[model samples]
Target: MTTVTTPDAIVTAARGWIGTPYLHQASHRGIGADCLGLLRGIWRELYGAEPEPVPPYSRDWSEPSGDERLWAAAARHLLPGGAEAPGQVLLFRMRSGGVAKHLGVQGAVGRKPTFIHAYSGHGVVESPLSAPWRRRIVARFTFPEV
Candidate 1:
């Protein structure tokens, strides 16, 4: 038996992982996860298997390679959408001209906007979508409904 996954379900599953310790290249619910790990964990909960095998990556996962690896992978797997919906995946560039490496799942939208991410030193936490964060958004995507 498999669970029916919806946008709301994705948000709920991601929220359930709040407080997990941030760990590079790891993804286990309530254990450890990075920004990408958090998303991968939610994906596992929504679907029985990972869409593709993730290669072991360094803390700087392809930034030196000058490729938008995270953004590319999101485009390949998730549905493209505007960043105005709960459960949408958000890709961010840490700095101008940098690769879009950070990721988060949108939480509350419109009023009291927030997003869930496993930030370094912060672990998994839902952060307010402040103007600074909003400005860094490079791409948005939603999990494909099952």
Candidate 2:
């Protein structure tokens, strides 16, 4: 992978994994990856190392504990902001009253905005940032400038 230095580079790297199969906690491109795995993969491509070791986690890892573990971790490694520009990391709450766990990379902005994510049944896809999906967005972050 080429060095990822700009937001455009981040978006390009993420878009390159468009068809990767979805597998829980896996990060290998074209083989399998969950939402977080997608982010991890991008981080590796950009920085050549993971910011931190991610312990094994289940689909409902933090539901019982009611903790925002994923959001907390993103905050630790990503730049916090409300910018809706391309390449931003988006955090979503899949269900009301639950932790925000779902993640996606912003792919486009302006009319017909889209985001790339690894969906369970659909593998990796770029989906329209529709109103229903928009409502679930809890936080937006960008990769630190390297």
For residues 1-146, write the lDDT of model 2, one tens digit per residue: 45655879988999988999999999989999999999999999998889899999999969999999999999999998576889999999999999998999999999989999998998888999999999999999989887
Per-residue C-alpha lDDT of model 1 across residues 20-57, encoded as one tens digit per residue:
99988889977899999998888888887999999998
Q: Mark the regions of model 1 whose C-alpha exceeds 4 Å error after superposition.
A: none
List lDDT for all candidates, in order: 0.89, 0.92
User: Can you give the lDDT of residue 30 in candidate 2?
Assistant: 97
What's each prediction's TM-score?
0.95, 0.96
Q: How far is candidate 2 from the true structure (C-alpha RMSD, Å)?
A: 1.0
Highest lDDT scorer: 2
Determine the C-alpha RMSD for candidate 1 after optimal superposition of all C-alphas.
1.3
